[model samples]
Target: MKKIIVSILLIFFIVGCGLKQTIKDTAQDLTNNTVALIDDAIDEITHESESWQATLQELSDNLTDEAQSTIRNEVQNLATRTIAAAGSEIRCNVDFLGARVVQALQRIKAELLNKPIPQRNPAICQVIPTAIDMNLTPNRRNKVDISGYDFDNQPLKLYLITNDNQRTDVTHAINRLSHYHLVLNLGSNGVLLNETSSRLVLEYKDSQMSSIAITQPVTPDCKEEEISFSPDIITYMPTHTRGDRDYGGHGPAITARVNIYVDNNTIKAKIYMRARETKSDWSTADGSGVFTIYTAPSKRRILTIVSDKETSTNYIDSGHAEDFFEKGSGELVKRFAFVGDTDGDEAGTRTRVKVTFNRVVVKLKEIGNCKE
Candidate 1:
C-alpha cells in the first residue's frame, strides 16, 4: 500500500507541472495575438464611425478579467524579483511573457461617441550626431570630433552654449574643421575657457543636438557616472478647442494635459482635464476609472486608474520605452499614450478625453563626475 501511494503522488506532481506550462503557453499566445491586433488598429481607430465602438467593445469583452488577473499576478511577482536582483542600475523587467493588455476599449470610447478629436502631429526631427567627444588641455587649442550615420554635411554650424543660456557662434573661428572634426581655440580668450562646464551645440540644416560635453582622456579622481533620461518631464495640452460628448449631449470645449515621466526607476503617467471655457467636468462618471495605458504592438495593458483624482504609477514591467539613441531614426520617444475619459465635474455630466500622440524613446545617460 505504501509503495502504491508513493507512485501515485509522483505521477500527480508531473501532471501538475505540465498543466502549469500549458497555461503559460496559452497566455503567451493570447499576448502575441493582442499586440498584433492593436498595432493594426491604431490607424483605424482614428476613423470616425460607430463600427469602431462596436469592434472595440467586442475586443474588450473577449479579454476576460480572469485572464488579465492571472497575468498581472504572474508579472508582478517577476517584476518584484527582477527589480530586487538588478544591480548597477535599476531596470524595469522586460515583459518576455505576454501579460500586459492594452485598454483599446477606453481609447475608442473616448475618441468616438460624438466627440471632436484633436489633430496629432507625428512629424519628428532626425539626423543627430551619435558621438561628441573632445580631447583638450585646459587653456589650449582643442580638437573636437563629431560623427554619426547619414549626416547631411551641407550647411553645418557649431555653436558654444554656456550655463547661463548664452550662445556664441564659433563656426568661422574654428580652423581646419571638417565634416567630422573641429579645431576649437580653447582658453580664456578663445571659445571655451572651461572644458567641463560648457557644451558644444552641433547644427545640420534645421536639426540640432544640444548638451555635447567634453571628456578627458585621463583623470586623477573620477567619481561614479550619473545616469539620466532626456526630456525628464513631458507635458501635453490640447491645441484645439474641440469638446467631447457627455451624458448631457455636446459639452463645452475640453482641455486635457498628459504628463509622462520616470521617477525612482518607476514609469508614471497622469492626466489633468478641465473645461477650456470653464474649469468644470474634472472627474469621470465611472468614479475611479479615467485613464489607461497599453503597451505598443501587443497593446497589453500596463496601467489604468482614476485620473484627476489620483496618480497612476506602474513598474516598468511592460510598455516602458527603451532604445532611445538609435542611428538614422529621428528624435522621437516611441511608447504608449494615456487615453482618458471623464464625466463633467457636476453630477449627470460625462465627457471623453482623447490623445493620439503615443511615441517614446529611451537614451542611456552616462555623465562623468570629476573631482576638481
Candidate 2:
C-alpha cells in the first residue's frame, strides 16, 4: 500500500510540473501574439494618416492652381478690352506694356487650363481698305454721277455713272463701280452716299413758245370770180383774189416723262401719258393720227427725256428741286407732264400742257438688294 501511495504522489508532482511549464509556454506565446497584433494596428494607423496628409496637399495645390487661373483669365480679358479701346491712336511704350501684360495674363491662364496661348497677329486687327463718302450730281441732262471720298476725307474715286432702265443688269453696274472703291471691313464703314447722291435736272429755253415758225411757206390760192356789169355790155370776167389760205394742220405732239429709281436690286420708273389727241381736218393735217405723250408718275422724278419729237418727245427737265432729308421722309421728288386743251376751242384747234409731280424715294430700312 505504501509503495502504491508514494508512486501516486510522484506521479502527481511530475504531472503538476508539466502542467505549469505548459501553462508558462502558452502564456508567453499569447503575449507575443498580442504584441504583434498591436504593432500591426499601429502601423496601419500611421499609413492611413500619411495617405490623408498627401490627399490634403494635393487638394490644396489644385485649389491654388484654380484660383490663379481665374485671376489670370480676368486680367487677360481686361487687357484685351483696353487694347481694343486704344484703337489706332495707341502709340509709345505704354502700348508695349499693355500688350505684354495681356500676353502674360493669357499665357498664365492658358497654362492653368492646359491650353496653348494664341499669339497676337497684326493682321487680326489691321485697318484695311478704309472709309469713303460719295456725292453725285446731274450734268447737261439729269445724269447719275458717282464720286467717293476716303477715310482721310480725301476724294477716292468716281466709280461709275449709269442709267438703270430696270431691264439692264444692276450687278454689272455695281461691278463696274466697285473697281473704283476698295472693299474693306465687309463694306460696313466704307462707301457712303448722300440722300441726293443721284439726281435729275431739267432745263428748257422758250418752253412757253406757243408756235414754232415753219421753215417752208404755205402756197397761196386765188379763186376765180364771175363779174357781171349792169350796163348794156355785160361781160363775165374771172376775178383773181390772191390770199394765203389757212393750211394749218397740226399733228398731235407726243411727249414722255421718265422717272428713275435706284434701289438695292430693282431700279424702275412709272410712265403715263399726258393726254390723248386726235387729228382733225384732213386737208390741213394730212393724216388723222392719235398722238400720245407718256408722262412719268409724280412719285418718280423725270430722270431723262426718252424722246422729244413733233410726233413724240420726252423732256428731262429739272423744273423743280426738293430734298429727301429735308422732308424727313427720306424720299425724292419726281415730276411728270401732261398735255390738254388750255383754251377751249370749239374746233379743237388749241392744246393745253401742264405737269404733275410726285415723290419716289426708297426707304433706307430695306435689305438684300444684291445677292449671288
Candidate 3:
C-alpha cells in the first residue's frame, strides 16, 4: 500500500507541470497574431492617404490653367472693344468736317486762277478799294460802295454786291478779292493798305469786301546791304548794245525787282526783269549772282555766289532764308545781304551784266548764359 501512494503522487506532479507549459504557449501565440494584424491595417491606411493627396494636387493644377485662360480671353476682349470705340470717334469727326474744308479750298483755288494780271504802266497803276459792308438779312438789297486811294493818294473805285443771298457767293467773292496780290490787312477796325506796286489786294471781313491799292515808285527805300522784312526789292539797270546785229535790239533800260519771299526760306530770291508793261524773263547770264550775308557784332560777311548755269545749279531760289548767328552762342544780330548779278563774256549774245535786287530775312540765335 506504501508503494501505490508514492507512484500516484509523482503522476499528479507531472500532469500539473504539463498543463502550465501549454497555457504559456497559447498566450504567446495570441499576442503575436494581434501585433501582425495592427501593422497590416496601418500600411493600408497610409497607401490610401497618399493616393488621395495625389488626386487633389492634379485637380488643383487643372483648375489653375483653366482660370488663367479665361482671364486672358476676357482681357483681350476688353482691349479690342476700347480700340474699336476710339477708331469710331476719329472717323466720325473727320467725316463731319472734311466736306466743308474741301469746298473752301476748292473755291480759293478757282478764284486764284481766274484773277487778272494787272497791266503795268505809270498812269494805269492798279487800284484796290476796301471798307464795304454786307447785310446778313436775306433778299434785302443792301449795297456797299467801296473806294480807296492809290499809293499816290489818288481816288480809286470798286463795286461791292452780294449775289443771290447765298453764303457760297460771299465765299466766292472773298476768294476772288484776296487773289489780287496786294497787302490788305485789318488794324483796329480799319483797313491798312500797302499799295506800292501795280498789284491790287482786296480783303473781305465781316462778310464785307474791301480793296487796297499798289503802285510803283520812282525811288524806293534804298539800302546798300539793308536787312529787310518785305522780302522783295526793285531796281533799274540800263541796257547795253553788243553782240550780233541780226539779233533783236534790246530795250533802252531794264526795270527789275527781286522777290525773296519764295516758299519760306529754303528757296533763294528770283531775279526778274520788267522790260515792258508785261514782259519779264530770267537773267540771260544765268547764275552769275552773289549773295553776301552779314551777321551783327562781328559783322562777318558770308559770300555765296552761283557761278554755274541756271539749269545745272543745285541752289534753288525759293526756300528758307539763310541765318546769321554767333558761333557757340544763341545771339541774333540784324542780318542783311547784297545780291547782284555780274556780266560775263562781253559779246552781246552772252553779255554778263551785274544783276542785283533780291532780299530775304535773317535768322537769329537765342540768348543764353556762357558755359564755364
Candidate 4:
C-alpha cells in the first residue's frame, strides 16, 4: 500500500511539470489545468487507498478465522495430552501458546486496518481437558465405572476422536445410576470404540470442563456388582478377602472373607474365619452375626455365630467377641480385634488364624425406618 501511494505521488509530479512547460502562454489556462491534474491525482489516490484497504481487511478476516480454528483445535489436543499426564506447569505452557496466538491475531487485524496492534493478554489462558479414558471393544456394551470418582450430580459429555485428529462430540443415555457406578447405554454408537479408546468428557453444572481422568483403572481381586444405597449411605455392600501364611508365626496361618451390607437402617455382617494347621486337618468355624449400631454406648449381645467346627484360642474352645466403636451417622464404624494365641495349640500342629472382612470401610446410611 505504501509503495502504491509513492508511485501515485511521482506520477502527479511528472504530469504537473509537463503541463507547466506546455502551456507557457496560457498562464490562466495552465493554472486551471494544473489544478485539475492535482484533483484527478487526489481522487485516484483516494479510490486506490479504499480498494487497498478493503483487500487488506479481507485478508485479515480470513487469517483471523484460520488462526482461531487452529488455536482452538491445538488447545483441545494439548488438553487431551495432559490427561495421561497433567500438572500446573504444562497448563502454563499451553496458556502461553494460546496468548501468543491471540496476540498474533490482533496484529493481523491491526495490519488490515493500518492501526497499531494491541498488547497480548497478561494472564495465561488455561484449557483444562480433564478427559476420561474409556477402554472398550467392538460389538460390546460397556459402562464406565465411575465408582472411584467422588462426584455427584455432575453433567457429563462424551467425545469420539477420529483417525484424522477430528473430535466428534457424542451423547450418552444413562441406563442406570447407582452409588458405585453410572451405567451408560452406548447403544450402537459403541461401534466407534472399535478403533479408539472410549473418551468420556465429564463436567459439573457450575464447574469447568472435565474429562474422565479422575478414575484410575484398577483390577480388584473381587468385583461386586454396582448397587444403589441411600445418599447418606455413600457406600453399598463392600467385600474383602485375604489369605496368606505368617512365616515368623507372628500371627496364625489363616484364610478368611467378610461381606458387610449397609443401608438406610441397620447393618448386616457375614464373617467366615478358619484356623488352619500346616500339617494335619483341624476343625474350622463359620459364623454369621448382626452388628448393633446406635447413638448410645451399650455393650449388649450383638453377635451370634453358628460354627461348622469350633476351636479355642490355643486350639482350645475359646471364642471371639463382638465389639465396635460406631461414630455418628454417615461415618466409619470400626472394630478392634485382638486375636492372639491365647491357647498354645501350636504344640500339636503349627497353625494360624486367617480373617477376611468384606471391607475395612463401612459407610453410614440415613436412619429412615432403620431397625433401631
Instruction: Identify the candidate with maximal lDDT.
Output: 1
Per-model TM-score, in order, reads 0.20, 0.15, 0.15, 0.18
User: What lDDT tens digits, residue by residue, belong to model 2 across residues 140-230?
Assistant: 1122222121112222222221233112111112211221122221122322233322311111131221111111122333222222111
- Decide which is better by lDDT, 2 or 4: 4
Rank the models by lDDT, top first: 1, 4, 2, 3
Give the TM-score (vs. native) of candidate 3.
0.15
Model 4 CA deviation exceeding 4 Å by range: 1-141, 148-152, 163-165, 187-191, 194-198, 205-372
Residue 145, model 1: lDDT of 33
Summarize candidate 3's per-residue lDDT along 88-189 as a digit string, tens digits: 222223222222222322332222233332321112112223232212231221222222111122222222222322111222222112111222222222
Top candidate, metric TM-score? 1
Error of 1 at 362 (Å): 53
* Winner by TM-score between candidate 3 and candidate 1: 1
Q: How does model 1 score by TM-score? A: 0.20
As a whole number from 0 to 100, the lDDT of residue 125 in candidate 4 is 26
